[model samples]
Target: MLEPIGQATAAAQNIWGDATQWGVGTGVGTVSGGFEFPSVEEIDAVLSSWRARQASIAQRGNTLELMVSSLTQQPAEDDATTGYIATWAQSLTQLRDQHRSMLEYIEDYIKKLEAAKQAKQAGEAENEAAVQKTAGDLAQ
Candidate 1:
């Protein structure tokens, strides 16, 4: 059981890389002076990466749920064993909820990124049109 948990933890680490690599909690949505917005391509790349990992996150959540279900089948003839099983199930449930929350976060972030990309592209198009119009005006 612990081994499965360790494997799940490793999977999570693989998805996010490391603690500092998590941009979900910080360094997002806030732009300081001189901070450049990500290029459309960069935003696409991030969306692609997170979309790829979304399935794995869902799988981890499923695994945690399975683990919780398995705890119910464990032999708990003694009071201590029953308490331990209850505790283990509670921990697994918490982990599953965390995974679900992370998945939701990723989904929301991806949508926001997509919206930003669209806005950037639209702005670029407008600028290009303005440049063309000014060029025509100058020729006339």
Candidate 2:
């Protein structure tokens, strides 16, 4: 639901990156400011919420399918109304699949971002430790 807002925020960050390349001679250049980076926990929570949404969608789809089946069995007289309901049989399923795919992609990306952030932090820590050891060795 609110995933599109998050995506738009990410898009803005990327757009800000482009400004750095064009502004050496120019007087006033765009500065990086006011960017809110979401924590891993926030991302995880969002992913979980989306998963729950997916489950609800699946369950609802199943229920709707059953209802539609019952309607078809009864054989309605109105072709126009029946035809519209029939279209939903395909549309609803497609909507579910598309939503699932999108959520999966977002969850995967968030997980990967978390992994990369952890790896970077670990590497920085190792470097600091190595520098401290070198300084201690020199002091002795």
Note the residue pairs that clash in candidate 1: none
All candidates: TM-score: 0.70, 0.50
Please list the residue runs of candidate 2 whose C-alpha ends up more than 4 Å from where it truly belongs after superposition.
Answer: 1-77
Model 1 per-residue lDDT tens digits across residues 1-140: 22334777789777865654334322234465222344678878877998889987887777787787788686858999988888888888888888888999999988987877787677778889999999999999
State the lDDT of candidate 2 residue by residue for 63-125, as single tens digits.
655655654553555988778767866676676677667657766765655554465456567
TM-score of 1: 0.70
Who wins the TM-score comparison?
1
Q: Report the poorest 10 consecutive residues by lDDT, candidate 1.
A: 20-29
Give residue 84's error in model 1 in angstroms: 1.0
lDDT of all the models against the reference? 0.75, 0.59
Span of ten consecutive residues with least summed lDDT in model 2: 26-35
RMSD of 1: 9.5
